[model samples]
Target: MIVAAVDAQNLVDALGLGSIYALMAVGIGLVFGVLRLINFAYGQLIMAGAFTLAYASRANWSTWESIVACFAVVIGLSLVMDLAVFRPLRTQSPATMLVATFAVSFLLQSIALLTVLKVQGQLGMPASTVARLSQAVTIWGVDVRKVTIVSIVAALVALGALALLLGKTTVGLQMRAAATDFTTARLLGISANRVIGFAVLLSGLIAAVVAVLLTARTPYVQSDFALHDMIYVLVGVVVGGIDRLWTATLGGFAIGFASGVIYGALPTDKTAYLPSVLFALVIVVLLVRPAGLFAPRGTSTVERV
Candidate 1:
C-alpha cells in the first residue's frame, strides 16, 4: 500500500509538471507559427518574470501585486524583443534570426546574473511567499501540492480559451492564416505587424503564467531557472510534431511526464543518468517517427497556429 501510494503521488506530480511544460510549448510554438523562427530566448522571458516575482516578494508585495508585476515585465519584454530584434530581422535568413535569439538569451542571462550580484551579492533569491503553494493537501490518502492542482487547471483553462480564440475570433483567424503562409496572408490584407504582435503578446502572457506556476513549484530565483526545462520542451516540441500546435503541446507533456516518472523510478544515486536515458529514448522515437510522434503520417512541415 505504501508503494502504491508513492506511485500515485508521482503520477500526480508528473501530471503537474507536464501541464507546465505544455504551456511553455504553446508559448514557444506560437512564436514559431507566426515568425517561422524559433525563439531560443523564450526561457529568458520566464526567468525575467521569475526574478520580477522574487523582487516583488523582497519588497513585501502582496501575491496579486507580484503576479501583476510578473505579467507586466514578461509582456513588456516580449514586445520589446519583437520591436528591437524580430522586426529589424524580419527579412533576414532563418539562420541569422536563430543566432540572434541565442545572443539575446545569453545577454538576458548575463544581465540577470550581474544585476543580482550587484544588488544582493548573490546569484539566487528566495521567493518565500510564492513557495507557500508547495504545501501539500491530502486527497484520497495521497498528498498533492496545491500548485500541482493549480498547474493542471491553468493549463486546461488556458488551452480551452486559446482554442476558442483561434476557432471563433477574428484575430485568431488572422494568426492562423499568417502561420499557414505569411506572404499570402499579407497579400490578402492581413496585417503582418498586428498578427505577429498579437502572437508575441499571447506568448508572453503564457510565459508569465508559467513563471508563477513554476516558481510555486521551485521557489529559488536564478538566472538559469527555466533554462534546462526550455531545452527539454524544445525537444518535446520537435518530437511531438512542431507543425501543429496541439501536437507540439502533447510532445511537451509527454517529455515532462516521462521525466517525472523516470526520476521517481530511478535509485537516488543513479538519477544522474536520467537526462542521458531520456534523450536516448528521444533519439529512438525520432528515428521511428521522424515527422513527429503525434504528427499524422505523410504530414508536411507546414506551419499551423
Candidate 2:
C-alpha cells in the first residue's frame, strides 16, 4: 500500500513537471528555430510576468484580471526586447548574441530584486493565490493539486495550438521557411522582422502561461523564480534534440519526469542532491548520444520547427 501510494503521487508530480517543462521547451524551440540563438533571458519574461501578478494581487485584483495583466506584460516585454536588442544584433556572431542574452537576464533579475524588495519585505505573491492553487483534489483515492491538472491541460492546448499554427497558417509557413533557412527565406520574400517578431511573440505568450502555472505551484515570486527552471529546460532541449520542436519538447518532458521521480524517491533532507544526480545522468546520456538522444543518426543538426 505504501509503495502504491508513493508511486501514484510520483506519477502525478511527473505529469505536472513534464507539462511545465514541455511548454517551456516549445517557447525556447520557437525562438531557436528562427534565430538559432539560445535565449537565457527567456526566464526574465516569466519573472516579469510573475511580478505583474504579484502587483495585481497586492492591489486585490480579481484572479482573471491578474492573469490578463500577466500575459500583457510578458508579451509586451518580449516584443520590446526583440525590437530594441535582438533585431539590431541579428547579424552578430552567435557568441555575442548568447552573451547579450545572459546580460539581459542578469539585468532583469537585478531590476526585479531592486524594485520589489522595497515594496514588499521580500519577493512574493499573495497568500490567497497560493492557498487557492495549493488546494488538493482527490481522484480515485489519490490526491493532487488543482494546478497540476491545469498545467497538464494548458500544456496540451498550447502544443495543439502550436501544431496548428505551424501546420496550417501562412505565418506558420513563413516561420517554417525561416527556420529551415533564414537567408533563403528572406530572399524568397519572407519578411525577416515579421517572422522573427511573431516567433518572439509566441515565446512570450508561452512564458506568460508558464508564469501563471509556476506562480500557482510556487507563489513566491522571486528574481530567480524561473532561472533554474529555464536552465533545466535548456538542457532538456539539448538532450532531446534541439533541431526540431517535437524532439525538444520531448526532451524537456523527459528531464522533468526524471527529476520528479528522483525527487519523489529522495528523503526530504537529501533533496539537495537531486541536481547532482540529475546532471550526472544528463552527462551519461550525452556521452552515449552526443548528437542528442532523440536526434537521428547521420542527420544534420538543423530542421524546421
Candidate 3:
C-alpha cells in the first residue's frame, strides 16, 4: 500500500484545520508576546464560548446569533479575567501571571465538567449543541463539512478585519505601542493598562471563534478538551514565534498542516510522538532565526495614542 500521496481533499482538510489552529495560535501568542507569560486560562475562553453556544442552542437561536453572542460573552469574560486575575498580579512577576491563568483555566474546566450533563434536582441545561455542522461541500468530488467552510471564511474575515484594526486604528496604534516596550509606552502617557486590556479582549474574541468551530466538530464539550488542545495551539505559537501577530497566524497554519499530515499516517499508538516532532521543528527554527519566521514586533515609532 502507498504510504503517502497528495490529493485535493487532503489539501482542503489541511487548510481548514490549519486556519483554525492558526486562529488559536495567534491569540495565545498575543498574550505571551505582550505579557511574556502563558495564559493557561486561554483555552477557557474557548470553553466559555462552547458552553454559551450550548445554552443558546436550547433557545433555538440561529447559528449566527449564537456565535456572535458567544464572542461577546467571552470578550466580557476576558475583561473580567484581566481585572480579577491579571491586573493585581502585574507587580508580582511573569510566573505569577502564568499561575493565575492556570488557576483560571482549571476553575473554568471544573465548571464545565460539573455541568456536562443534566444536574439532578437542579436546573438542567437544555443545550442542543450535539451537532453544529450540516452539509458537506465537495472540492473535486471530496467531502468536507460546511462548518469547515464557515470556519475558513470566518477566520479569514475576522483575522483580516483584526489586521486592519491593528494596522489602521488609533487604539490599535496604542496596542502596538504597548506590545513593544510596556515601560517606555507608559512613559509616553499611553495607558498600558488599556492597551493590554484590549489585547486580552482580542484574545478572548478569537479564542471564542476557535472554540465554537472546534466544538461543532466534537460530539460534546469535554472538560479536558480545551486544556489538551491548547497545548497544540501553543505549539504553533512557539514554532511560529510570537514576535508578531502574523507570525503566530502563519506558524499556526503551518504547524496544523504538518501535524495533520503526520497524524494521518501514524498509528494510534504512535500519535503521542507528534509533540517531539513539533518541538524539534521549533528548536530548529529558533536556532536559525531566533526572532521567529516573521518579522519581530515592530518598534513603537509613533507616539502613544
Candidate 4:
C-alpha cells in the first residue's frame, strides 16, 4: 500500500509538471515558428509576470486584478522586446539574433535582481494570494492539488484555442505562410510585422498563464523563478523536434514527466544528482533520434514552416 500510494502520487505530480512544461514549450515554439529565432529571454517574460503577481499580492489586490496585471506586464514587455530588439535585428544572421537574446536574458535577470534589492531589500517575494491553489483535495484516495488540474485543463484549452486561431483565421493562414517562407509570404502581400507581432502576443499570453500556474506551486518570486525550467523545456523542445510545434510540446511534457518520476524514484540522498542523470538520458535520446524523438522518421533538419 505504501509503494502504491507513492506511485500514484508520483504520477499525479509528473502530470502536473508535464502540463506546465507543455505550456512553456508552446510559448517557445510559437515564436520560433514565425521568427525562426530562439528567444533565450523567454523565461524573463515569465519572471516578469511572476513579479507582477508578487507585487499585487503585497498590495492586497484582488485575484482578478493580480491576474490582469500579470498579463498586462508580460504582454507589454513582449511587444517592447519585439519592437526594440527583435525588429531591428530581423535582417541579421541567426547567430546574431541568438546572441542578442542571450544578452537580453542576462540583462533582464540583472534588472530584476537590482530592482528587488533596491525596493524590497530581498531576493524573493511571496505571491501569497495565488498560493491557495497549492492546497490539495483528495481524489480516489489520492491527494491532488488544484493547480495540477488547472494546469492540465489550461494547456488543453490553450492548445485548442490556438488550433482554432491557426486553422480558422485568415491571419493564422498568413502566419503559416510566413513561417513556411517569409520572403515568399512577403511577396504574396503578407505583412511580416503583423504576423510576428501576433505570434509574440500569443506567446506572451501563454507565458503569463505559466507564471500563474508555476507560482501556485512555488509561490516565492525570484529573479530565476522560471530560468531552470526554461532550460529544460528548450532541451525537450529540441529533443521532441523544434521545427514542429506539436512535437516540441510533447518533448517538453516528456522531459517534465520523466524528471518528476525520476525524482520520486531516487533515494532522498541521491536526488541531488537528478539533473545529471536526466541530462545524460537526454544526450542518449539525441544520439538515437537526432531529428527529434517525436518527429517523423524521415523528417529532415530543413525548417518545417
lDDT of 4: 0.90
What is the C-alpha lDDT profile of model 4 across 1-305, one tens digit per residue? Answer: 32443588888998999999999999999899888888999999999999999999999998889999999999999999999999999998888999999999999999999988888999998998788799999999989999999999999999899889889999988888887788999999998899999999999999999999999999998999899999999989998999888899999999998888888777888889889988998999989998899999988874532
Residues 29-105 of candidate 3: C-alpha lDDT, one tens digit per residue: 67765676678788888877887877778678887888788888889888999899888888787777777888898
Tell me the tens digit of each residue's lDDT in model 2 across 1-305.
Answer: 32443688888988898899999999999999999998899998998998898888888888888899999999999999998889999888888888899899999999999888888867654524434777899998889998899989999999999999999999999999998888999999999999999999999999999998888888878888888888889889999989788889999998988888778877888879989988998999888887678888865654322
Q: Flag regions of model 2 displaced more than 4 Å.
A: 1-6, 123-127, 300-305
The order of the candidates by lDDT, greatest first, is 1, 4, 2, 3
Model 4 clashing residue pairs (backbone): none
Report the Cα lDDT for candidate 2.
Answer: 0.87
Least accurate 10 contiguous residues by lDDT in model 4: 1-10
Full ranking by TM-score: 1, 4, 2, 3
Best by lDDT: 1
* Cα lDDT computed for each candidate against the true fold: 0.92, 0.87, 0.74, 0.90
- What is the per-residue lDDT of model 1 for residues 220-254, given as tens digits with 9 covering 90 to 100? 99999899999999999999999788999999999
